[model samples]
Every structure is written in structure tokens, then in C-alpha cells.
Target: MKRLIARALRRLGWLRYDLLISPVAQHPGKNAVPPGELWLVIDTGVKKWACMSCPGGCGVQIALSLNPDRRPRWSVETDFWGRPTVSPSIHQHRACSCHFWVKKGVIEWCR
Candidate 1:
């Protein structure tokens, strides 16, 4: 069933979804990670650099550092909501296979 699949994916750490149990503003200066140029080092050598901006519309650039030695990493660019967030983008969207990750954190590189 769909629920079973979601659970399995979650257990594997490949899926993420969030309900705003608390508002971003509630944490104020605590969770005040700026939207753009956000870098998350998920595990030991896996790092993700996300830069987001809005000129007329939102744009997101995501880069992955897959190796500990590599300073120059591969990158991709797309619209906002490129990853799962508390607020989903009105522009880009989730694919059927990736809907779950969007809600933990997901998107870009056309995977």
C-alpha cells in the first residue's frame, strides 16, 4: 500500500515531509537559517549547498559535494521548491515518485 511504501522510504532516510508543528517565526533567531546559500551536511561526506533567490520569480541552485576531497562539486539549477520545505513552491512541483521526499527535503538534478 502507499502508506507502507512511504514508511519504508522514511525508514531508509530517503523520504521527508514536515507539518509546521511550529512556525519558523516562532523560533525567530534560533532556526533563522537564511533561505539562500543554505548548506546542510547531511552525513559524513555528503553535503548539499542550496542557493535560492527571487528576482521576478524564485530560482534555486543546488550543488552536491559527494566526495570529501573534491572542492569543485557538481551542481544543478531549478525553480523553488526544488527541495521539500515547510512551504511548497507554487512553481516547480513534486513528481509522483518523489512526493514524500519533498515534505523532508527533496528536488533538482532531475533525479
Candidate 2:
């Protein structure tokens, strides 16, 4: 039933696999995140965190620091269409251990 609804949404151009940026003043909790969406927490013009759900379907939320001062940090770029490309790839060390790259809003899994 759910799959059918998803397919219908896809057919209607409502459901997409691409990642879209949702800027927020504050970082949202994991439960508030939706799949195929990236949340950018911007506080006073500073990019603080990039939050998103694991595309691996493990239901784990991944948050990457955007601070260059931090040892482990990531950068995000978006095209005119608002499709996001995350640099340095993402590797989940725990949970599902999914590693992938987000380029032009597409998920390229690391094998």
C-alpha cells in the first residue's frame, strides 16, 4: 500500500530521490527530519551543521559539522535548482555503516 502511494507520488512528480536543502535557524532533532532532504542549520549567517537522514534506510540521522575550524568538517554546494552536493563523501562508522557521496543530489554508494 505504501509502495503504491510512493509510486503514484513519483509518477506525479511529487516524490523525488534527489536531495533538497531546507535551511533552518536551529538544528532540528532526528525525528523531525524527512528522507531525501538535507537540513542546513544557519545561525546568524554561519553554516553550523548539515543534517539529514541516512539514505541507507537504516533510519539513522547523520549530522556533519560545517565549521572549518573543526577537524572533521564538510562543505555543501547547491546548484540553481537547489540540488545539493556534499563534499568529502559521508561514511557512517556506526549503525548501517553506509558510505556514499552526494553529487548533484544523487547518492553514489561506496562499494
On TM-score, the leading prediction is 2
Cα lDDT tens digits, model 2, 33-108, are 8986899899999999999998988888899999999969999987655567899999988789999999867789
TM-score of each: 0.20, 0.82
Question: How far is 69's C-alpha from truth in model 2 (Å)?
Answer: 0.2
Per-residue lDDT tens digits for candidate 1, residues 1-111, read 544565566679775532111112111223333442233434443334322222112333322343436655433332232333423232334222222112334322223
lDDT of 2: 0.83
Stretches of model 2 off by over 4 angstroms after superposition: 1-17
lDDT per prediction? 0.33, 0.83
